[model samples]
Target: MTDDTGYEFFEHTADVGMRASGGSLAELFAHAARGLVALVAEDSAIRPAETRAVRLRAASVEALLRAWLSELLMWFDTDRFLPAEYALGAVSATALEGEVRGERFDPARHTYGTEVKGVTRHQFRVEQRDGGWTANVIFDV
Candidate 1:
């Protein structure tokens, strides 16, 4: 369940799942965004030439995780800004604030062969384990 970069990745029947541990909520959200970006593009290869602002609120940490991913998808749909890197200014059980950098999505520049239809509720899970946050997401890949 480890990718070539050594980040653990688990592929289920529908989508993929990964785990990242952080000392703070901001770091955890940042890492979670990184993991999601890796699912579509190479983290290092994604050019950081554009910036975007995002604000999201949820009822719980698990909902916040889904909201974060949904916001990324919205940015991709509207601006074509594929997220390469993300920095979280704040995060909590119900809210998140962050910025992501990436190149404008160009079919020539950024080739995402597989289409992610959308995030799904099936098997969706997020939890805190061992003093760290873990998110299990299933997308309609």
Candidate 2:
């Protein structure tokens, strides 16, 4: 991440939001993942031990932002995997593919821990930027 006024993270009443600026759509999505994980744990501390596959569709960028964060949360709820790293394999006008890797949550390993209730729409936003796109998304933790 650079300091070109590229991205910023904001705290909301019940969730966290991030506004990312990049030259491409993939960069924005990847940064958003990084921002989301930053809310839960240090990005450097999270180690990838397993790989998972995910697919999603949304009518708009805002909806996609919600779907993206919710998908990450779903991995925690269903697979117990904490996503700390994201590698966006493909990105299209309306779709994306990637692998999110992280170690399974362990009581002993995770600190400052709080369960993420869900991804919410209270303060969600995603839109085009000067070069590409920027998204403001809120997630419940």
Candidate 3:
């Protein structure tokens, strides 16, 4: 996938890989989440008509990222939600609190993409470099 939001998808043997960078950890997380949503459905077709609250904590940044994406995937699996907008109120190395706005999937109005099964730890990483944050995540498709 290609986009101007500091995120990109890379070819993986049996899965999908995403790399996202941002000036802040919050932005990086948001970009990664967007990438995940885009993988499930055409992001342009998703609308911010509903909102959901998110609060997560982990022992480390990498774990936090995994939890964050996993939460989003859970929402999709349970409610067919596709988030289009993100409002991260607080973001730290091990905690994140935010709100995501989007609507449930509508097959007639949305183009379905890959069905992501889960976020994997293979080559997964979140780091701060050159005064910015970057994350690499792999999704089991």
Candidate 4:
């Protein structure tokens, strides 16, 4: 994350890669969710008109990260929810509980640059360095 507590997009051949970092794991994961939002819409314009509690279980932190994003993406594609703010409550290597805040994706009001079809495991990672934490994830466009 640079100026904002957010994530950055990396150039991928046919998809997109995200590098999310923060002072803590919850922050990093929240930024990662913001990264996914950045991939689809303008975060600043998205109003927190609704909130959805997201819960997931995984075999590892990496899997949990992907599952979290995947659940959000599923909401976008199926439930039409476009998340902007992430309120990560409890998170561990195997479990996560969080709430995503954003209203349903209204194409008339929201500006989406691209359509992220799915999240991929390729080059997916979650690591904690001495200073902070970071994660890398790829998305299928």
Listed in order, each prediction's TM-score against the native is 0.80, 0.79, 0.95, 0.91
Q: 2 in model 1: Cα distance from truth in Å?
A: 6.9
Kindly report which residue stretches of model 1 are placed more than 4 angstroms away from their true locations once superposed: 1-7, 17-21, 42-44
| Alpha-carbon deviation at 29 in model 2, angstroms | 1.4
Clashes of 4: 0
- Which one wins on TM-score? 3
Lowest summed lDDT over 10 consecutive residues: which window, candidate 3? 1-10
Q: Write model 4 residue lDDT over 61-107, tens digit each, in one string.
A: 89888888888888888877887777888888789988888888787
* Residue 58 miss distance in model 3 (angstroms): 0.5
Better-scoring candidate (TM-score), 3 or 4: 3
lDDT against true structure, model 3: 0.90
Q: What's model 1's overall lDDT?
A: 0.68
**What's the lDDT for residue 1 in model 1?**
26
RMSD of each: 2.7, 2.9, 1.7, 1.6
Candidate 3 local lDDT, 6-110, one digit each (tens): 789998888999998888999999999988888899555788999999999999999999999999999989999999999998999999998999999998899
Alpha carbon lDDT of residue 56, candidate 3? 99
Candidate 4 — what's its lDDT? Answer: 0.83
Residue 100, model 4, lDDT? 81
The digit string of per-residue lDDT tens for model 1 on 46-106 reads 7878887778899988888878888887776787678777777878899887787778767
Lowest lDDT sum, 10 consecutive residues, model 2, at: 35-44
